[model samples]
Target chain A: MADYILGVDGGGTGCRATIADTSGKVLGTGQAGPANIMTDMDTSVVNILSATDAALLAANLPVHSYSRITACLGLAGANVSGVAAQLQQALPFANSSVVSDGIIALQGAIGDADGVVVILGTGSVYISRRNNSVTMKGGWGFKVSDLGGGARLGQKLIEESLLVHDGIYKRTPLSSALLKHFDNEPHAIVRFAHDARPNDFGQFAPLVFEYAAQNDPLADKILKQSVETIEAALDASMHDDQPVLSLIGGLGALYGPRLSVRYQPRLRTPQADALTGAVALAAKLYTQTAQS
Target chain B: MADYILGVDGGGTGCRATIADTSGKVLGTGQAGPANIMTDMDTSVVNILSATDAALLAANLPVHSYSRITACLGLAGANVSGVAAQLQQALPFANSSVVSDGIIALQGAIGDADGVVVILGTGSVYISRRNNSVTMKGGWGFKVSDLGGGARLGQKLIEESLLVHDGIYKRTPLSSALLKHFDNEPHAIVRFAHDARPNDFGQFAPLVFEYAAQNDPLADKILKQSVETIEAALDASMHDDQPVLSLIGGLGALYGPRLSVRYQPRLRTPQADALTGAVALAAKLYTQTAQS
Candidate 1:
């Protein structure tokens, strides 16, 4: 049996790997470039391997020790057709399984409990687990959905800025800042958005939040609309059993207090990060198989 | 001086060319494949030439008489930096100029009259004219703006369909039809959207309108929201002298009755189509230069 377990959390932005013992004691963690399986499977595999190798090296283990490690990889685009299967077949670990990044986030947030985790980052998704059965809402991606995520917020800000430029929306300091950022050229914003990825748009999300704190009306309007969508998503994810809710991701804490009062009592902090949850999953799967 | 005037209306879907005498009398018209300069300038040039050649042939003129033509091209993506200049230099005519597709649409709708034309096709844009002075409101393109256009409606349909699939949104006949169309697979919708262009999403716009006609509540809600945005755009377009309002494009007629009653009295039918408008502009420019 493998003496070590590995966990990988891969997304469009980057890939992170954690190495731990069979008993769930973490030894080291490492990160590498993006590993979006849907975009490029080969690159994702390479990134996963690179992150794993670095984690093992950080744990004082030989790079070749990869073959003896069982791994669970949770990655964005894993839910796409044939992506997870392809990644599992391409992985170098002794035994490995691939799942969506949302699943790992849910695992990390609730740790086998019946609950839900709403990740608000460059993208947004709601992952719920009840008695080991898992379901998901949203996370269709940036262009089609992701409602209240940073990317969506940033996109709304740009749209409002352009409207202000056109004299359609009232000009405010927020819109002025955005127009100035793009050199006061509507075409520049259009050109930038034409080829921009979610993370690229998410970079402007902080500006929206910053302006909102200063009571900018447009910023406040954008945030209010965003929170309404997020609230709707949260309401849709609930059940009579009242699963504990944990808001997770880079923007999670910032958005948490703005959520409806009804959800206040149900909100809980995550027990571990997604990387730890991935390693925990690896340990659970490998140990069970070995005992059987 | 050029003996003939040529007008070309080029867009992502296709390109149309019209040939007319210097007196503004139509000679013939022709069409070819898409000529969006931003995606492939070479293809745009080829398509434009093909349409022009066909138009000359239909006009019973020698194909080699292209040099006698003064062409005015109103093309999608021409407004992008360097595109119009590149196209102007590449066009095969005695003299040529390039303008945005929206400009020709506005010209077609209002002639030389000071007015506003709101185009509601696969994309949306508001173009206003006052004493030869032109200003634009919303043609920023899909995913960022184009709020009430076919592409946005179709994209919203897909998003709602996915939400219904995940039980986040209530299932209606519209969402059911959409799910059935994609074989009830959320992944299929995701895959289709992942690589879909604006026109691809625009293909689903008819479905939304069809369902709305059948009184589907979800469809009505979507349409209401879309119309509100469009109305906001129109209101923003109004100046001290209320310009004659012209609603144009494939979805324009359908949305006309739904607009606020205040715009009804001002709404007027277009005097000519975009192709004719292009030819008219070509005649006006070349004729003036010939006389001068």
Candidate 2:
């Protein structure tokens, strides 16, 4: 009988699930709707279940093939007091452990080493790991202090675009693009913000990155400021002179290679994605917890 | 005929109108409903008329008794494009100039001199005046910036309070007080936010300030952070090494005494409130425009 493991990285944008074996080989992966516990808990659970089922089916496993299968969820906002407990009770995993999405991402990226993991997707978080100790720097939601995240960058883009549109500042190609994209209606944009979630706003972040890639000054400034926020978070969390660093999440992987050039030798490549790490953690915990 | 001049500072919490003579004698004052432009334009106009009517009634004068009444409106959200123009057309006055509340506050304190004005009420704005040229730093609506304002402070208080109520953080006296005050149901507060206008949230800012004054660490942190935001805005907008500064708006005036110790030599006491400054500007502009 094949010993199977499941891992889920449930983020604000979507839920990603990976089916793997005990030897750490990924068999299949699947995705579903947003799985952030903070915003929509019901949808998140449904998405997680859907993604997991798909991944298992993709791995060619029967519905009840592996009764001994274990799962772990690295879920966004699961660390908010009773959230993890509530989610554990809600999800369909018979043998599972629920932890913060950050912890699992850190584990996936650096395994058991001392390092800083900065996840910058729709939301952003900085996690420092050292010898079984973990410290979180920032993740104060999208409204308050999501400095280097996609939401932050998107907001900046919209604000700057408005400035240029209003003739308050010099027009740039970014402004023109934003005006075109948003149909030049400021109030409509504001109304859009009233309805859109963090992840929805994050969809526009790639435009800023693309503009930055093309060396647009405003876009360059946006990227510079964003990098500074991430750097500051890392500096505050990591006390060591030269701590190993890895990146995860949507933005982190997208910009990880380029970011490595900025941080140079201190930056190390991640061993696994958040989903793989979650699966590994699940299998490891099931072995210990079940035995205990 | 008495050459009476009226000064009206219409805010989110309430509308305050002062009836003073050309000799700068304080005759009477009146208050009414919230007059922030962001709330509802018609309501603000009605509030202004009501407050002005009350001030006139209190002064034992019939309507239109004043020979020359020039009113300055330092209105919230007047900074938005075309909003000031709309407000100017709405209000009934011999002469009126509509501007951001920060502008009139700066003028009230420093007249035509170079200065920085910090208007802290439901929202906050920093304005710089240098040689007749004006510059604005921050105050990009309540959602994006307005960091030190009442709404932002209230949000912090509520967030912290909720965290403690949920047992996410170690309970502090401030948190306990907050929970007791809100009856331990934060969703109720969220409901209030949905139904609230700008001034409604601003009303709770005093509670935080009161707690801070009582030496509560969490309250102190929040209040201190708010002050820091204002200070940063001032610093960003200030042109010279030593620029005159003014504190306007209800919260600004209330907190002005506390801030004076920190700003000391740079903080210039206002000769009149924003209303008077707005009146002065209106009179000047009305005459200039009429002659032209």
Candidate 3:
């Protein structure tokens, strides 16, 4: 029987699980939706398990075929008190480790080393690892912080739209274009705000960047403020004189240039995804628990 | 017949009005809640009227008693389309003028002369006035911009609270105190967040500041970032070779020391309130309109 390892990145927007064999060969991957443990714990757990089953099927292996199975899941809202226990109890594996989505991101970015990994997806977090010990820097879950990520950018975009609506901001083609995209509905803006989530709002960030690229004042202002927020987070988190910092997640590429300009003197991109690091950590954990 | 003026300054948190005679003597003042026109149009009008009534009663005059009464209402959300007209139609004064709250703030600070006025109350806006012309700066409202106001600061505080909740932020006395404060009941944080206005959350700013003064790392970080925001707003609003800048609103005094330390050579404190400026403008308008 072949031993297997699985790593899952469960986010607010979606769920993704990657499977690998003991020989470190990529087996298969599976995807699902709305798997943030904080907002929808039950659905997230169900989706994560379904994704795992799908991954096993994709790999042409039955769940019970492996002599040993280890899984690590990095999930949104997993940092909420008692969430780890809840997730672990819910996500079935021969052996499972549940940690905040940030932990897996840190592991994925720099395996088993002391360093900081900044995740910029629908939300953001900074995770630092030192000697198998984990320290987190950010990822307050959309209600508070997560600056320079998608939601923050999106909030800025909507705000610009409102300003254009009010004539406080000089409307550019971009502003008009966005307003039209929302059907000129006055309540459209308010409704969006009412049901807004970090990633849900983050979807508008690219538009903001596009407008900024086109030299719109409102968009430009939004971009600058976003950059400043991310920079400040980096500054607050990277307290070491010379810390090894990495950026990951969906917005990672989009925010790269700005982050580089502001923090490259003290930061660098990681070479791996959080899933990979999670797999590695799970394997190590298996070894440790097995030894103990 | 003692000519009187009615002055109003309606912001995000409340509406403030004053009754005064032509010599700039303030006879009475009144306040009412949450009158930002952008959020509550009818309520904003009613708040202003209520405040006006209160001011009249305070002045021992009937609403219709003052001969040659003039009014200037500097109102938030007045920049919205047709909002100025709507407010004018609702106001009781026969001779009245309306403008964005920013304009009245600028007038209160520099009195129609060329300079910049940075108003930092529940929200923030910067205005630049030259002679009879106005070149508006910041004050995009809470959704779009508002660099150094209580709302932005409150937003930052909420973000920090999330960070602390997520364990990304280091545990500090400030965090615990904040958590305890918000932990009025189970899931009180969530309930508070869902219902919180910028000012409601901003009521915590002084607490954050107090902790920072006592050397709490997280609080210190929050405030330093706030200061940077003010600096940025000032920078973006003022063309380097432009006129001297003035600070107004409640937060101005709190921010003055730090702002002065950095930009003292160019900073001035306004001696008048937004309502005073509105009254002054009203007086000027009354004399002109009567003569015309």
Return the lDDT, model 3, position B265: 73
* A7 Cα displacement, candidate 2 (Å): 2.4
**What CAPRI class is candidate 2?**
incorrect
Native-contact recovery for every candidate?
Answer: 0.64, 0.00, 0.34
Residues B1-292 of candidate 1: C-alpha lDDT, one tens digit per residue: 3499999999888999999888888888888999989889999999999999899889888775878898889998877889899888887788887998888888888888888899999888999887678888888989688888999999999887887887778999999998999999887887898899988998998888888999998899889999998888888886657558888998888888888898888889878888888888888779777777
- Cα RMSDs of all predictions? 2.8, 7.3, 7.2
lDDT (C-alpha) at residue A110 in model 2: 87
Q: Which lDDT tens digits does candidate 1 get at residues A1-292?
A: 3489999999878999999988888988888999988879898888889998899889888886877788999998888778899889888788898999888888888888887799999888998887778888889888778888999999989988887888888899999999999999888888899899888899999888888889999989998998998888878887758559899988888888878898888889888898878988898888887887
lDDT per residue for candidate 3 within A1-292, as digits (tens), equals: 6678888888766888878886567898888887877667888878887787778889887844434678878776676688789878765577888877788878777666676687887767677665556766555545566676788778767766665664455777777877887797545665566566666787887888787778888777877887776766666665564357777878777677766454666566676887777777677766766678
Which docking category, incorrect, acceptable, medium or high, applies to candidate 1?
Answer: medium
Please estimate how well model 1 matches the true structure, expressed as its whole-model Cα lDDT: 0.87
Each candidate's DockQ: 0.61, 0.09, 0.18
How far residue B105's Cα lies from its native spot in candidate 1, in Å, is 1.9
Q: What fraction of the true interface contacts does model 1 reproduce?
A: 0.64
Question: Over the stretch B1-292, how does candidate 2's per-residue lDDT look in tens digits?
Answer: 5556677676666877877665556677787999877658898988888888788888887765533566666776677778789888876676777777777777776788887787777777677788788877556555545677898787777666654553334577787877677677554554465556556666778888788778888888888777776665565567565368877666776667666365767776677767667656655664565577
